[model samples]
Target: MAARSVLVAGGGIAGTAAALGLHKAGYDVTVVEAHPDTAEDIGAFLTLASNGMRALAELDATDAVTAVGFPLTVLRLLDDRGTEMAHGPLGAADDPALRYRCLLRGELNAALQAEAVRRGILLRHGARLTSVTDAPDGVTAHFADGTTLTAALLVGADGLNSTVRRTAVAPRTQPRYAGQHVYYGYTDGHTHAATDGPPTPPDTRAITMVRGSGAAFGYAVSPAGRTYWFARVAGDPLPVGGPGHRTARALLPLLRKDPTPAAGIVEACAGPVMVTNATEMPLGTPWHTGRVLLIGDAAHAASPATGQGASMALEDAVVLAKALRDSPDPHTAFARYEHHRRPRVEHNITVSGALSRGTRTTPADRGDDDTLTAQLAWDTPLPAAPGEHA
Candidate 1:
């Protein structure tokens, strides 16, 4: 039989990574992105945890990603008074390839997209998906520019505001605020310094998390003496439209109250501070209907408290491809994929939501590390779904 043809919606981290995985799984994958180009949300930065790195390795795109970002091997915790509370190795810190990595969201997206294109995957930019038609035979994607493409399956890897999820899977579902406003910014230590404040710590590969009285703050200094930091403060959601042009100055007061370097870093920020309301999808939202299925943020978006959004998306790509490659048909593949994914991602959403809402003090122990390691291993066969023969 001929290789199955799959159409993936959205060209961000999740979508592009899905293309890479599907192509590697011996499928004819075509990626359609609404954006005119690869550049997007240049201000935001994120860390891909160890599990995400393992997923990238399974897709054979680790080098493509590792080349752009800096590694983070240690995690440090500090109290509101700038006192060190605890410190330890980050995820898979012993392995260079599997260690945590930090980089601009746009850079990571560009790297994945470029790698996909280089591997002969058909990636069409500016192909905005206006709607989707999932017939019994196949699924057809309708573009805003009056173009249409039919494929055996459609994967929605679009971000939080995914058109595919809203139009096709769950029209009534909506993302709810996770009870905090997140602010992130960058400051160059070489040029910017706190005039009278306490001296900021030297640049290390460690990500420092501050337990403030009013907000949760974290920062990591790059190898080049640049600091990337974020603060999550309890607040009402931003205006319904979006995070307007908010500056870092608004956070100075809260940071200063904690006696930490967070305030100084914000004061010395080199450019505009970006802010967004932490949002997550409701549990039990439908992920698929017939030949169309949702993955990544479109299916399950958690708050930034866990820092697992990108990692979860990357994991989604690899597992979805594996399910399709191993299953007898699309229906089995979607079922297997959901069976394996829903529990883990939903746990993240619940934990992160609680943390954001101040209902939880610490993340629960994830006892599934070994199981996850096996699942992301490319050479390892995926486990059969419950009540199905292996």
Candidate 2:
């Protein structure tokens, strides 16, 4: 097959990274993102495990991300009564192969976009792909603005509620509500320790999960100096309001009643807060069609319970780009991509969920009982297996 031009939809972390990865492979690439510009601030901080950083490193943005973020020393786990359960060092701490980093989602996205554009890739912000049609020769994208563009392959990096996935994947199932509703936000805090005073981001965290008929609280110091936090109530009683602005005043009391004291710290957070309705689509087979393919949440929407949503997405980008570069036929590349990604992603979600089921009702371990264990403790490194072509 002749070398093909590629179109990537979405400007978020995965989309921007895909644009850069494909461009490095010498494909004429264009990225269409819904965000007006890449400069917008992402209020929330995300933990980029050592594995996700490895994938980003391939796109040459790992250092850029680290510039804005930092490594985590420890992941401290606790029971609801706030007693330590498990504490392990990250990176060389667990396995010599293990590594973990944290970052602001927006900053990472910005870095990838800059690198993508630096490499001569076209990145169009405020562009939303409405639909796509593919043939043996190329793929054509129809935009919401009624504009059309052609490319050799179209990548659906749009996201969990991805329109690209909906149209291409067919009768796409509606995302299921995770049993818990989450309240989350970020603020500056050098001390990851529960105690006050000057603090350093810890190799270990003061984290807990109290078994209760009620909500669960989670706290951690992200790569950035901010203390990132979240809480989950049994049903969907989320505090109404947006972040960095006005939040439902009623939310504090509800969160205050949380079993873990971490919930109180989150409650004390007087800055910005968002009561989010977290949802997920179970793993699906056949991650692609012909010239159009899926990456990240657009392909495998993992339950955040696994804390591998970003990791899985990053891995998808790495594997997909590698497969495309090697396979002469786009179809073959798509199949191979699915084979490599689908099973692993499905397993990650399943195992994380099993741990979460224990969290919902409270467990033998206070932190393990209702807290999101999978999200905090373990990290999976990026799969750097040489592509069949490489």
Using lDDT as the measure, the top candidate is 1
Name the Cα RMSD for model 2.
Answer: 6.6
Could you tell me the TM-score of candidate 1?
Answer: 0.96
Residue 338 miss distance in model 2 (angstroms): 0.6
Per-residue error for 118 in candidate 2, Å, reads: 1.7
Worst 10 residues of 1 by lDDT: 190-199
Q: Can you tell me which runs of candidate 2 are displaced by over 4 Å? A: 39-41, 91-98, 188-213, 222-225, 237-260, 356-390
TM-score of each: 0.96, 0.80
What digit string (tens of lDDT, one per residue) describes model 1 on residues 1-390? 133999999999999999998998899999999888877788889999988898898899999999997999998888878787989988889999899999999999999999999999999999989899988888899988898999989999888998999889899999999999999888887432233445655646799888998889988888888888899999899887668446787788887887777777788887887889999999998999999999998999999999998998999999998899899488888989999999999999999999999999788755229888888888787887897653
Error of 2 at 127 (Å): 0.7
Best by TM-score: 1
Count the clashes in each prediction: 0, 15
